[model samples]
Target: MIEILNPAELARAREAGALVAGILQTLRSRSAVGTNLLDIDRWTKDMITEAGAQSCYVDYAPSFGRGPFGHHVCTSVNDAVLHGRPHDYALADGDLLSLDLAVSLGGIVADSAVSFVVGGSEPPESLALISATERALSAGIAAAGPGARTGDVSAAIGAVLGGAGYPVNTQFGGHGVGSTMHQDPHVSNTGRPGRGYPLRPGLLLALEPWVMADTADLVTDADGWTLRSATGCRTAHSEHTIAITDDGAEILTAPERARV
Candidate 1:
């Protein structure tokens, strides 16, 4: 469903977006060497409950995934990329971790993800992969506006990742989000410009650009939710929920800037 949120709905969306951003940021800070993946999920649940918000994932039963995700947050480490179900493993130094979250507050939903390195080891390849996705996400956001098309955003994102020498995967990409998570107007990571659904004011889109280091192929883990790189190469993903306005696209899921 393509939803054009009204002003009041938009306001609610902002609140939801902020909650999603804050949770992801808090989880990112708490994740480090020796930190258990299940702990991250628990932290997410606690924060969401404290904020009076609902998790879009925990009870989520989508056709693409096994029924009832049963996890508060997605924790993708190293070779894992999308739909990373939290497990019992502890993070290690230099491990590339990606956290993806979606939640609803006031009946509005927002989604976002971030990829970063853990502990002290700074692997060059992992850093580059993370950088590429971040840049691609920025490019996609820049292409979104009232008159733009979804393809324009996809093309802009593709340029960055492709230029960086990473293969693009269309199997899973961004999508529309509103009262519920994962709505219509599927936004692929790569597409031709001037195609697909045209942007309209009050439209909300979650733009995510993810890539594996060596291949575009993905393999599902035994858990039936976590998606990993076929080659076991490191991967990265970046995402944000954006709202279309008369002027341009507003990043609803951006982290709050600390006040000095």
Candidate 2:
């Protein structure tokens, strides 16, 4: 459902966004070579509980997924991209890790994701993949504002990923977030401008741009949740929850502190 949040709801949304961002930042800082994926999930649960917030994913049961997510956060590594279910695996140096999180605070929800390389080893390809998604996310946010079309945002995001020589995947993209984790007004990664739903003030959208290195195709893991690249190539994903305002789009999930 499409929801235009009221002023009071928006205030709560900001709080939810801040909590999600802080938790993700903390997780990213703690994840490194030799860290187990399950540990990341545990840490997320602790942080959410400490903040008195709820996880949007823990009970998330959608048609595409096997069953209830049963996890506090999504940990995607290397070839894995979206809906990455935490498993019994340890991260290695140079492994590209992506953490996607959604939380509810005061009954409002905010979602965000970040992809980064683990440890000191920065593989050029991995860095490039992450950079492309980050740039695309920025472009999409820049194109969002009052009266803007979802297509405009999608087009802006597509330009960056395409310019970076990455194929865009439309099977899964961004969506509206409000009282729940996912909502209406599906935001594709690539589309024609001046089309789709028009932006309105107080509207919250999670604009995510993800891409695989060589193919747009995806293969589901045996676990039935993790989506990986068809060719086993590296991948990256970047996302942010934005609020459309009279002035412009405001990034709700921006990191409070600069990455060290």
Candidate 3:
């Protein structure tokens, strides 16, 4: 279902969004070479609880996934891209990591993701892959506004990735988010413009642009979670939750000090 938040509800969403953004920023700060994935999950759990908010992922049992996610956040490294279930692995210096998270506070939910290299190490190929996704994300956000069709956002995102020679994956993409985590108006990474639902004010959307360096195919890991590149090529993902307003779009899921 697609949901539109009233002004008061939108205010609550800002609170939820801030928490989601702050936690992600903190996790990114704490994650480094030799950081354990499981430890990162534990820390996420603590932060969510400390903020008196609910995890939109933990206990989340979506059809695409195995059972209950049972993790506070998604920690995808290297070839892994989406739905990354935290495991026992320790991060390496050059590992490309994606941390995706969602949370509910005061009856609203916000979702976001970030991709970065561990230990500040960047290989040329990895750098290009990561850069492509970030650029695509920016394009998608720029296309979001009232009267804009969902496909417009998708097309904007696709142009960035396609122009960079990366194959787009449609199995999973962005979505409408509200009191619950996922909702309607699926936002694929690639699609024809002017097609699909027209956006409107009060609607909250989580637009994510993720790409695998080489292949469009994906393989599920044995963990019954964590979707990885079928070709084992590295990947990157970037996302933000935004609210539609009369003027334009407002990005809610950004770090506390991140410039709006």
TM-score to true structure, per model: 0.98, 0.98, 0.97
- Per-residue lDDT of candidate 3, residues 137-236 (tens digit): 8898889999999999999999999999999989899999999999998999999999999999999999999999889999999889999999999999
> Which scores greater on lDDT, model 2 or model 3?
2
1-260: candidate 2 lDDT, tens digit per residue: 89999999998888988889898888998998999999999999999999899999989999999979999999999999999999999999999999999999999999999999999998999999999999999999999999899999999999999999999999899999999999999999999999999999999999999999999999999988999999999999999999999989999999972121
lDDT of 1 by residue, 1-260 (tens): 88999999999998888889888888988998999999999999999999998999989988888868999999999999999999899999999999999999999999999999999899999999999999999999999998899999999999999999999999999999999899999999999999999999999999999999999999998888999999999999999999999989999999982110
Candidate 1 has its poorest 10 consecutive residues by lDDT at: 251-260
**Candidate 1 collision pairs:** none
Ranking by lDDT: 2, 1, 3
List ranges where model 1 is wrong by over 4 Å.
257-260
Candidate models: Cα lDDT each: 0.93, 0.94, 0.91
lDDT for predicted candidate 2 compared with the true structure: 0.94
